[model samples]
Target: MSANKTAMGDIASSTETYPFEKDERYRSQQGLNGFAVKEPFLPNGLGLQVRKRKMVRKRKNVDESPFSVLCAWVVEHQIGLSLNLLLLLSLTHFFFSRARPYTSLFLGMSYYNPKSKKYTQGWEDMYFVATWIIIITGLRVAVMDYILKPIARYGGVNKPKAQVRFAEQGWLFCYYSLFSPLGMYIIYQTKYWFNLREIWTDFPTHTMNGLLKWYYLVQFAFWLQQIFVVNIEEKRKDYWQMFSHHIFTSALMFSSYGYYQTKVGVVILAIMDVVDLLLPLAKMLKYMNFRTACDITFGVFIAVWFVARHVIYMMVCWSMFSEIPHVMKQGCYNSTTGQMISEDGGTAVWWNVMQPFDRPGGTICYNNNIRIAFTALLMALQVLTLIWFGMILRVAYGVLSGKGAEDSRSDDEGEDEEYEEIEYYDDKIKSFDGTNEIVTRTIALPIEEDVNAEEMNLGLRRKSTSPTTASAPRRSTRRTGSARATALSIPGHSDKKDILGRIGCDKPS
Candidate 1:
């Protein structure tokens, strides 16, 4: 026992004069105590020698130009800047009548009629649409960073990747929750609420109510903002799928509004938004490690997705095929008068279709080409949703197999850390008697803290460390001979598999 204690003391003392002693580069790479080698010299001859290659530390050059600094500041405070701009515009519009027309173009509803209490779709609506995109972007940032992050921390979501995912899901939950109900309300008031055929009855002359118009425009803005968002945020395995979904969705909204199909547009929006609410809820619960809650929410999400996207939404698409051709008259009409012109330069028979007498402009028409384009866009969106549903079914299978749900498409957080190779002797340690000794031993050594200690301090690191075991455990006494031995245990060494398991792999699919 005394010999073993002396051997350990010698090893500890010898580490003080290690070849790379006090070398920051070595310490940074090998950890705080540097590399340790233990060899006890016996009275007889027993020797061991090890060689280590020197490592060079590379420093990154950081750009400190004024332009770079300004750009960094702008990115960091984008939400604040957007809010300030919005405030400035609101104040200008409220205080000055001369600026009202100009600022109202961005801040207020366009082509509004006070007598009828309605809004008309026009090119000028694009100004408000752009402004709302900025507003939604700012609101998303504020809600995620300020509201959801703190909630996630409180709920024990400590990993930086998990926290980010939680915040995203929380923000989406809020948006979808609010808008889903609003969309349903708008649909409830429309004649098409009971009859799907009414969607195309009046065609391009459907009355644009205030609630429906604003809902449609704001929804479009949100989808447009999402395109910028998905590109800026971390890229996932479903990057292209999400990107394409946002593109098709935004284009569909724009086309619907342009063709005066707000009635069907609102219905599709309501159906789509309903399913979105549950998915984010499930993701947020998963991030917080609520296993049961997440599983239950995921099940609900699957049901809603089928009902809303596959059943109800498909019905709307079918209506476009069966009802539109029968109800809508395809011909050139005067936008100024909503009068369908005959080939003889006279007004055609005044059918049951409503005339857009409220709108005065150039001639507009809804032809077969426009109908085909619209149908194709809607089908494209459906196909994207179907692809996502297939992914969901895989998750469901995982759950059934008792693996728990996980998002297979999500990428792992951070890059993998490379591990140094561990060399082994010829299954024996030679003794002073010149005979091979089969020694069973276990040694515990303090591992150097991870380089990202600051991130760990901020709860950004993925591992769950107990308060009592905050730092690495102290070294254990060395043992040799006859007892069964275990391999060296190193804490805080994360490989690619571990990282993937920590972040998205463990999430409910």
Candidate 2:
């Protein structure tokens, strides 16, 4: 590839004027671009900025290069070439991987387990993280050197390794699948624990008896890791993306486990195993740097478990119980039989405050129609919605703020402005051998430049849908020599460590 560098340099030097003129106007007015990524805790130390690459657009129409007549065809229609390749790659990954699941998963088992309480499941857990590490993190130097570099042809048109992006995405999905369900259960289990405490006079000793203590420990460890993920680790990694995968799937799992353990009184062994699994969390916490942010987070965690756990869970339980007849019936179980004798199996707490008579079948807990439905609807809508919607609002805020970068730029031509540090833009690009011509591509963000820049370093692209296209823009001038000459390694220099290993280029900035 370096052999072509001279020719590419010649092409760059010979070009009359770069199509992308230096624009410094919006450098300081980075409301959308700057605000969305900065780590509130780290201040200026290590901000997480995402420079999105625009997409590889399908050609306006295939126009063969005029130079193609004189020499071998240099395919310029990236989109057309890309679409064809995507179909092939997609088919291969789908069918071939499915055909040899064990091989693809590095001898791991992948099955659905609803009652699982550990971060990593069983035998499948081994394969899940192992194959995931390979795909997302990429094969070690050996595989890339021997296999990938030899047979691989077109990388993504304007971007880097397409496989890296695809694999990373999949790895992240798997990570979320592994942990989020357990995390949700942790939160759900707390409800029953706190509720049980309300009725028991000796709450401390009562909550920590043989099996119950183990249950609480599993619940705490799983969710404590989650709280770490939600607030801190995600600053670098795709905690939310991982959370998203499990959140939807766990909705049912959490409810089922909640009903099973708290209402029906099972999940003891499952809870103990979860404790053994997450025992590593104690070590994991010491690995992170502690600061005021960490202090506040831990403080809140203590308050939630020790204080709020006692108070909030009870109120949440009582209120949520009034909503659902089946759950209410289930929770008020016979200690001797331990059977939740209810015909229905919706969430335990299903009441409405605004309209009491409008339960899911218009059914009432203990047949108290108007009163039951009203409380249930109110809890689900008011309380649960706040928990759910607050999450949605934060993500929406991140994405929307990033998109509105252009709108927030000021017109001051002479004012000096400093922008927050964005993370490495082209870190996705890896060194490739001449045997394998690496390529990268992203969908175009569709934002035309409306402002100027002060520094020559224009972020390849900011956060937008299809950012890869913006990374390596299409220059009108042609190259005179070997096209793949310049050795561009994705920047990996980070003053602050990326804690959880952020995933993918398309994450919300």
Candidate models: Cα lDDT each: 0.62, 0.30
In candidate 2, clashing pairs total 48
Among all candidates shown, the one with the greatest lDDT: 1
Task: Give the Å shift of residue 187 in candidate 1.
Answer: 0.6
lDDT of 1 by residue, 1-509 (tens): 13432212132222222232232233453332443233433332432221232222122345699987886676678799889989998899989989887998898778887887767777788899989988998999899999999999898888776687789889999999999999999888877886899988764563477777788889999999999888766666578888999999988887677666778888898999988887777667666656566656666777989999999888988988888878877776665446777423223222211223224454556666666777898999999989888866765554444443443455332222233321111112222222343222222222333233223232221221432122322222221111110011113321112111212223422
TM-score, structure 2 vs. true = 0.21
| lDDT of the structure predicted as candidate 2 | 0.30
Error of 2 at 466 (Å): 49
| lDDT tens digits, residue span 132-164, model 2 | 333322222233334333322232212223233
TM-score of each: 0.68, 0.21
lDDT (0-100) at residue 300 of candidate 1? Answer: 75
